[model samples]
Target: MKKSIDYSIEHKKWLNKRRNKKISVTICQFAILIIFIALWEIAGSLGWINTFITSTPSRVLASIYNLYESGVLFYHIGITLLETILGFLIATILGTFIAIILWWSETLRKILDPYIVVLNSLPKIALGPLIIIWIGAGMQSIIAICVLILIIITIISMLNNFLECDKEKILLMRSMGANKFQILFKLILPSAIPGFISVLKINVGMSWVGTIIGEYLVSSAGLGYLIVYGSQVFKLDLVMASTILLCVLASIMYLLVSLLEKIVLKHR
Candidate 1:
């Protein structure tokens, strides 16, 4: 009938609009990158910006090529990626457990909420040295830093999300003779899916920050180490190249998490 035809038209419009928006966003991102790079290269070539300190794109590429030729490129990349992934996964798991614990106990939640806020606000870099001293350097120290940065934040964030779930629904479940564990598993966790995915997105960035900071403190290898060494030796090109590579790697990681989010959204 007419109503069905109208509904079909509206659906088509929605689909087309969504498709256009996505295409525009992607195009904008690429355009911005290309424009910025072109500007940077022009400025460097024109000596409007000091290429020695700013480091031109050509120099960065040459440095990367050198690293690739030396066979140290993948080694450092792999180390940093491994550390970042390990920290991200472990922090997510630990944070989930802590969030659940906080949600389960009113007394504990009251006691710990302020502490979690304080810990999250504290600059993690200030503790990097202490972490290195305690963990005695290496990948363990890097991971510990990541966990420190991510876990409390995750717990605080997700616990708030858990608290925001529909109270009426919880009450109905309670009336139906649902125990705490049953309610948690069936309703609370399911409701918090978006929050958890958000946490994953956040953790992706935090993982890199934590790993790089940790490497700055104690790593003999990895991108952070390369950056530190490059600066010490006045090799600005290498520093810039390492930083650009970090950006690329982090973007790839974020894209993977975004893909996961899409899958989760579609399934839901």
Candidate 2:
């Protein structure tokens, strides 16, 4: 009975600590946001800054409400989100496969390493025109650009992780008559989970960048298209609203990836 009471107290303490941490984070995020918005509103209202060029947060919020009322915000957001998801998924799968192949073949890895580096080093924006030409001006091009941006990063990250696997454990597996595939499944891939999550987190932002660039190059729809249109029309409020929405979406993606990492780490 005494042991049970101690365990309950310890559990309560853990819960209290977790709750406090969560509240602290929430307060910090909102505090920063509030400070920024207050400053912007003050500057604009006081005529210390050009509201026409740099709209206040209030203006942006109004634009968001206006866009929502017009029912077009969701349409643009959906297109961008779909493109991001598709491109991210394709890049992750392709990158993992390439990493696996390179891990299995030292000769192939050496031969391809330079090419991978070159591809990774190439500015993705430079490929915007080519991708639009190849995929045509639509969601396909956007997805393609996003994939191009993320694939190299994912491959490099996963390959590095795969190569960092414990050599002793690999050798032990081989001595135990484990096949190449078995070794990869049991050791290499498992060991690379943290790296994979890291890649996903990185690629989430990259995916947004690629999509926005692609949209800027050519697109009739999407948040990027909205940004371009807003800039052309000199509607700073619209631009700010689109930017804030993008931030919110990226945050959601990050939180999801973090949750995935937590689950993976728990299993580990």
Candidate 3:
């Protein structure tokens, strides 16, 4: 009875510590944001800084409200979000499959390893003209750009994870007559879940980058288009609003990946 009570007290203390830490971190983040915005607003209002270049929070809000009233705000957001989701899912799935294949065949891995490194090192923007020609200037081209940017990175990261997996465990499974498929499913994938989650976190920002760059190159709509158009017209407020929205969407996507990581960790 005493030991049970002691265990309960200890657990409660740990929980309290975790809760306090989380609250402090959240408060600090919001505090920093609020302080920065307050200073920016003051600077703009006092004529201490050029609002024409930097824009102020009020102007940014007004711009967002204007976009909202124009009925194209959601439309643009939806297009970019759709492209981001599609590209992220396709790249993750395709990358994982390719990584598994490489893990399975040493000869194939050796043959393709150098090529993969080279592709990863090459500037993706250099392929923009070719992409425009091949995919032909639309959402298709945008998504293709995103996939091209993400796939090589994913494959390289995942292959490294698979290679770093516990070799002794793999040997044990092999000794127990486990086939390649079984070993992959039971051991390799489970071990690589954390790495996959890490890559997902990174790819959230990457997807947005790809989509925006594509939109800059060619798009009738999207936050990226808004940003480009805003800059051309010297509408700094509109550019800032589009940028803030992009940051929010990217944060949400990253949070979803974090939630998935927590769930996976719990399950394991």
Please report the candidate that would top lDDT against the real structure.
Answer: 3
Q: What is the C-alpha lDDT of each candidate?
A: 0.91, 0.91, 0.92
- Tens digit per residue, CA lDDT, model 3, 1-268: 3454656777878877989999999999999999999999999999999999999999999999998998888998999999889888899899999999999999999999789989999988779779999879999988988888999999999999999998899999999999999999999999999899999988888988888988899888889999999999999999999999999999999899999999988866
Question: What is the lDDT, from 0 to 100, of the residue 71 in candidate 2?
Answer: 97
Of candidates 2 and 1, the better by lDDT: 1
> Which lDDT tens digits does candidate 1 get at residues 1-268?
3454656777878877989999999999999999999999999999999998999999999999999999999999999999999999999998998889989999999987688778889987799889888879888999899888888888888889899999999999999999999999999999999989999999999899989988888889999999999999999999999999999999999999999999988867
TM-score, each model?
0.87, 0.89, 0.90
Highest TM-score: give the candidate number. 3
Better of 2 and 3 by lDDT: 3
Sort the predicted structures by TM-score, highest score first: 3, 2, 1
List candidate 1 segments past 4 Å from native.
1-29
Off by over 4 Å in 3: 1-26
Question: What's the ranking of the predictions by lDDT, best on top?
Answer: 3, 1, 2
